[model samples]
Target: MSGSHLHSHDHAHGHVPVHSHGPASPHPAQAAPWSILRMTVVSRLAAAVAVSAAMWAVVWLSMR
Candidate 1:
């Protein structure tokens, strides 16, 4: 209780102790851009319904 009236609380104590906080980042990978534009509009609407069912199966096999 006396050594030149000691006082230095190790820099006033408690200054840095965070398992997660600002100033130590490097954890990114949470895809988020409207889920890649909704998977590119559902793969261009399934390639425009498979090119309109292959052009309606070549116009119904050229009307047989």
Candidate 2:
């Protein structure tokens, strides 16, 4: 082995690879209107509440 310290350095120590797809749009100009967005949110919330109420009713009836 050579006494020089230059050839003793390691190459597999610190190396990182980065990957990227593309940029995303925050809000496109052709996006849905505010009224439609409001209706969608309201319907989802209503459905979730209905499901919870139905589950509670079922459990209460079973325990009675």
Candidate 3:
């Protein structure tokens, strides 16, 4: 998330830098633990699969 405002490329003309335009989004990286945990299914494979399926169902319904 870094950039140069006035650099070689823009030096030729005139370039302006910009920052994130809107509200900061929840970083997907921060959710890595829960997401990974959800993916893991050694002893709880059945429950994990069920939860995943339900999540998909909700997402599909909401999208529709």
Candidate 4:
């Protein structure tokens, strides 16, 4: 028999290590900072304004 046959291929191969550090975290939304949410809203608003400005520019140029 080969030396590789000595290796275990039963429950040892499917073992998952457990980890615990005190307690789990709270709700994801509650954990998130307000600045991140504000940045997202501001970015979306800026994008909408930019798109409207571009459309307006196109229409104004076409009127010439």
Compare the candidates by lDDT and give the number of the best one.
1
Q: What is the lDDT of residue 1 in candidate 3?
A: 29
lDDT of 2 by residue, 22-41 (tens): 24635335555555356677
Local accuracy of candidate 4 as per-residue lDDT tens digits, 1-64: 8665687656667676554442475434445554535577779799789999999999999998
After aligning candidate 4 to the native by TM-score, how far in Å is the CA of 46 from where it should be?
Answer: 0.2
lDDT of 1 by residue, 13-61 (tens): 6676654535667655676756535667778789789999999999999
TM-score of candidate 1 versus the correct structure, residues matched by position: 0.24
Clashing pairs in 4: none
What is candidate 1's CA lDDT for residue 18? 58
Q: What are the lDDT figures for the candidates, one per model?
A: 0.75, 0.72, 0.67, 0.72
Which residue window of length 10 is worst by lDDT in model 3?
26-35
Model 2 TM: 0.39
Give the candidates in order of lDDT, highest first: 1, 2, 4, 3
Screening candidate 1 with a backbone cut-off below 3 angstroms (N, C-alpha, C), the clashing residue pairs are none
The ten-residue window of minimal lDDT in model 4 covers 27-36
Q: Scored by Cα lDDT, where does model 4 land?
A: 0.72
Tell me each candidate's TM-score: 0.24, 0.39, 0.34, 0.39
